[model samples]
Target: MKVNGKVIVVTGAGSGMGRALSLQLIKEGARVAGIDINEEGLRETRDLTGKASAAMSTHVVDITDRERVEALPAELIALHGAVDGIINNAGIIQPFVPIKDLAYDRIERIFNINLYGTLYMVKSFLPALLERPEAHIVNISSMGGFIPFPGQSFYGASKAAVKLLTEGLYAELKDSNVKVTVVHPGAVNTNITKNSNVEMRSDVSAEEQASMTLSAEKAAEIILNGMKADKYRVMVGKDARFLDLFYRFSPKRAVDFITKKMAQMAKAS
Candidate 1:
């Protein structure tokens, strides 16, 4: 579905890809409702939109709160007249540790935000989305969703759940007006570690970071293009595309490759 002239809702709009997507949607002539837990970040996103700010509205709400999420459809409709699309971009990562060392509370938090939060937004807005002539739902998974990232096993699991959830939605909504797209993003320049309240190991090299990550603006553009074309699966970066193919042909080798790399990074840090 074309985003131009549509009312699109974007989660995690306070910063990173969410913020970039919101601004880009506004540029494409879409009215956007930007949701985020951080009020300051939302304000910053709105401010960055400048003249296009008139096309956007910022909502400060925790997506994990079912009551808040369920209320969003009505709220967005009131502000924008109708809801045409939603991008579930709000998610957090687990700490850089093995699952054995990971806390249960942390695991729950990761699943709640990455899986349940996406589920909430989709379920809450699905009815309204079906009412539109053409609507779309985009869920952001990760490269780690398919590839094994040793230290982030739980984070990978949460996103993998999202990947499957989105795929199932696509199957169910095939005959409906609402289109579903699942995105696998490689590393991108963002403050996810800070927002997730996890400390990055000091040893991760600058080169490693740069090599794997995409700019948030570029990632947003790729994602929006995929949404416009109504793609069922979108890979946000070259790394994501490459790793996806790598894992498909050699799953064991892919796992070993990532495991060894992460171990080296962990040791260096």
Candidate 2:
């Protein structure tokens, strides 16, 4: 679906890739409704958009709250007159610990934000999206969704659920006007660690961080391009593409490789 002139909703729009997506979509002549729990971050995003900020609306709503999520379409319609697409980009990571040491409450929080939050947005907006002549839904998964990282078991599981949920949506909505796309992103330079309030398993040096991660802006560009092409699967960054292919051909080898690397990182930490 072409983003030009469309009214799109993006969650986690306060920071990271979501902020980038909002800015980029506005640049492409699309009106965007940015949703985030952080009012300050949303203001910052709006400030950063300059004159293009007129095409954007910032909403401070928590996606995990079903009532608020359900009511978002009406609020957005009042502002933009119509809704064309949604990007479920709000997600958080769990503490860097083995599953055995993970708390049930923490696991629930991760699933609530990562999986159920996406579900709430999709379900809430599906009716509005279906009404559009052409609509798109983009859900951001992760490399951990497919290739498990040792200390991120629950987070990976949550995203794995998102991956399957998005794929199922695509299958069910294939003949409909709505298009669904799931994204798998490799490590990206974002404030996810700070936002999620989790300690990194490895104290990554600045150089290592830069080398391993894609910029949020670059990831946003790749994602927007994929959505414009109506691609069902969008993998951001070379690492995401390579690991996806590697896991497809050799699941066991991929798992073993990542496990070893994660084990070493954990030991170092």
Candidate 3:
């Protein structure tokens, strides 16, 4: 869980928290193998990690491809001689609309990448991970996974699966050296909406949206620190932390809060 000198595989290290996490890990002396669907994004992440074509670096790979993910452990092991950790961070939040209005194809794509992608990464690397005396798994869920949002039902569902999956892994690995952590992040200042096929409920103003509810760097810092502590659930921002409390203490109130937030957005638009 210590970032320094850890051989970590990070999926979807193209942008957002994934990118920031990769940079943070490398800075802390971790040897990172970064993967992303966006090769351009990977390049940017590589630049952030270090300006070198070193043994531990970034590459372009789609997580949704089962065959590729299956072969990943071998590839990584061949290069690094071991796999110490895996970050199942590849995800998509497309078709950000009501379930009824969302297209089936988009839903499938979202789940395939968000849920299945995470599963495949874990399945492919678990056996290898078991061999290591101490290993770790970091999954990135969303605030939507724990709370509800009007226009992102499918996204929420996919991440909720990851959240549960992470917890289950934690329970199973309790006595083992393999650590599992799921991170729930609030509105981060990432271009997720622009990059994703998801339709926003309301277009954020240029300034406000640009400002980001949370900075990716800050979120990444918190996540790495949480992993070091072997935290079960990491809420990246105040909003994420607060909603988690509401979900536990007053589930109905959280729903009401979401409903009201949606209504306000509708009125504002």
TM-score per prediction, in order, is 0.97, 0.97, 0.94
What are the per-residue Cα lDDT tens digits for candidate 2 across 214-239? 99999999999999999999999888
For model 1, the stretches where C-alpha displacement exceeds 4 angstroms are 203-212
Any runs in candidate 2 off by more than 4 Å, and if so which? Answer: 201-203
Task: Indicate which candidate wins on TM-score.
Answer: 2
Cα lDDT of model 3 by residue, 167-233, tens digit: 9999998889899999998878876776685456557786887575888889889999989998888
Give lDDT tens digits, candidate 1, residues 1-269.
Answer: 99889999999999999999999999999999999999999999999999888998999999999999999899889888999999999999988888899889999999999999999999999999999999999999999999979888999999999999999999999999989999999989888998999988675577767666898999999999999999999998888998999999999999898888877877777
Which pairs of residues collide in candidate 2? none
Instruction: Report, for every candidate in turn, its global Cα lDDT versus the true structure.
Output: 0.92, 0.94, 0.85
Collision count for each candidate, in order: 1, 0, 4
Clashing pairs in 3: 94-198, 95-198, 96-198, 96-199
Q: What lDDT score is found at residue 23 in candidate 1?
A: 93
Q: lDDT-based ranking, best first?
A: 2, 1, 3
